[model samples]
Target: MPSADRGVFSLIIINKAGGLIYQREFQAGLRKLSTNDYLVLAGTFHGVHAITRSITPRIPNSQPPPSPATSSPGTAPAVSGYSYPNPGVAVTGIDYLETDKFRLTCFQTLTGTKFLLFTDPMTGNVDTIVQKIYELYADFVMKNPFYQTEMPVRCEAFDRHLGAWLRGRT
Candidate 1:
């Protein structure tokens, strides 16, 4: 394992279906886990995230009482509440998880693909790193003719660009 002083530790990409799509280790500070363990972790996290989102309390909105004329028999009126974190923005599950040893940041794209980034607990600019990783995924993985959506990322260009970007950062 590498020293804790290093900024990044590893990354894990889970598809919208909770399948492990990508896994990479940027440093050696974290203990090694088997591939099966990583897959189990991804699935477990996905389930927990879903539950968290569903159970999130939404802010109530005030509205005038419905008039009898507008009310229809045996029909329920539509009711909604302001979303958590923001009103207009759609809900994305847990943003990040922090422990004494490391911080795990999760960035889910509009299409539901998630990027899990692991960094040292003291590291900064995590959002910037995640956004850059998203850009690289778009450019290299999405643009590759042979690549399939929501599939395991096997693009050489993606690996090269990601490594270069992180190397440049450090």
Candidate 2:
């Protein structure tokens, strides 16, 4: 825990299914929550993120009009609004949460596992730090022979690399 990595209050990892697989506190500014609370929070946030993506508005396209429902039986059914070609509403993913006391930055991996980093509201370069964390996870955790995807991270290599990186940068 060197330099500003010390500013990092905590980190939590959640699987795509919204299970809390890892939770660790790096600093002491905030009170600790029970394990059940952490699990509930992860699940609730996942649901909210999914809901936001689902509710995204469809993009408008210049495609020809769709056939009516009453069209001939063999006619193709109308395309759903989601079929529009544009990147509708830009619901790529949830990124972060800002509060008066803390800033929670979320980094989601391509495989859908999420990393939540809680830091002091005044912390800087969190985006860079989170990206580095993801890189470490990719190199150390994901590549470890004993590591299981979507499970709690237990790789000593990951811990060492992450700690060294953070210490160096901070």
Candidate 3:
């Protein structure tokens, strides 16, 4: 991938409750916000997610989506469709990057773990990169016994691997 295709602007990890658990910016030129403000945003999003799940309609004994048909029955339920109860955070929506210099991509795991990835707006294959990051988090952070849920994700291995991977890709 080209350097421009792999550059990341920042990342944020939010808890199920929408509390900002972790955040870091790699590139420059984005407007800065106070640490307190970032925390508030996370908490607000968490509330929105809870509201969404509660409002999401329950599907009773319904057939899975077409994409799930290719997978085994054991995994078919995992591929079930989702309906957004609210407009924004409830559905993993992407908030616009400030100044148009970057793009913000949000990924919400089925367990309500959220990863916010910031990248160059024009970058390609960002979803792959984000998936790798999520994999790293599951391996290095979530698996660590020392990591407490809803706390800041401060695993040194995660940072090292993420930086090294991004550097290698760029």
Candidate 4:
């Protein structure tokens, strides 16, 4: 299981366009931002991520060039660009994870799914916690017949299970 040391600061989810889809801060004493500001940040980040992906260089083909005499005549080659397993999202970057008091975990799903989990920077096995949260999201949010994609995640069961699991671990 992922670590649960109460060092988490916040989590943010961004859409393909960098719109702030979700933002939540868990730790105490951190400065709070208005909902509008958080949304702006999400959008800005999304734009930057897309720009970064476009700027990334494409890998060149590995095949050696054929000699003129042996070369096949006039076959067009497919052009490709630098590609990462995109998850249909522009970019998923974790800016801050380790600090004196907190750590951040960011997970992006294949359909541009994004999950950001914060924890104690010193906590061990944070991945486990992340996996469990993801599972809960899948079971409660994605699996629910009522959940609409790109909408705010508001399942009561999700909140309950998340609180229970975190409390238990802590």
TM-score of candidate 4 on Cα atoms, chains taken together: 0.69
Across residues 1-170, which tens digit of lDDT does each residue of candidate 2 receive?
34454468888888988888878776655788998899898898888767766765666555755658557778778766444235543454567888877898888777778889988777889998888888888898888888887888888887787777766665
Tens digits of per-residue lDDT, candidate 1, 49-86, equal: 88888887776566655666888888786454444657
Models, CA RMSD each: 3.4, 4.2, 9.1, 4.9
Judged by lDDT, which candidate is best? 1
Model 3, residue 20: distance off in Å is 1.1
TM, every model: 0.86, 0.76, 0.67, 0.69
**Candidate numbers sorted by lDDT from highest down:** 1, 2, 3, 4
Candidate 1 wrong stretches, greater than 4 Å: 1-4, 64-85
Q: RMSD in angstroms, candidate 1?
A: 3.4
Steric overlap count per candidate: 2, 0, 4, 10
The superposed Cα distance between candidate 4 and the true structure at residue 136, in angstroms, equals: 1.1
Per-residue lDDT over 38-119 for candidate 3, one digit per residue giving the tens place of the 0 to 100 score: 8887777667656654555644434646665566776535644553444354444443334466677767888777887878
Candidate 4 lDDT, tens digit per residue, 2-116?
4443544566776544556556666567878899888876776566555655665544445655556665678655334334464364544553346675676666667766666
Candidate 3, residue 93: the lDDT equals 42
Q: Could you give me the TM-score of model 2 versus the true structure?
A: 0.76
**lDDT of candidate 4?**
0.66
Q: How much is the lDDT of residue 49 in candidate 2?
A: 69
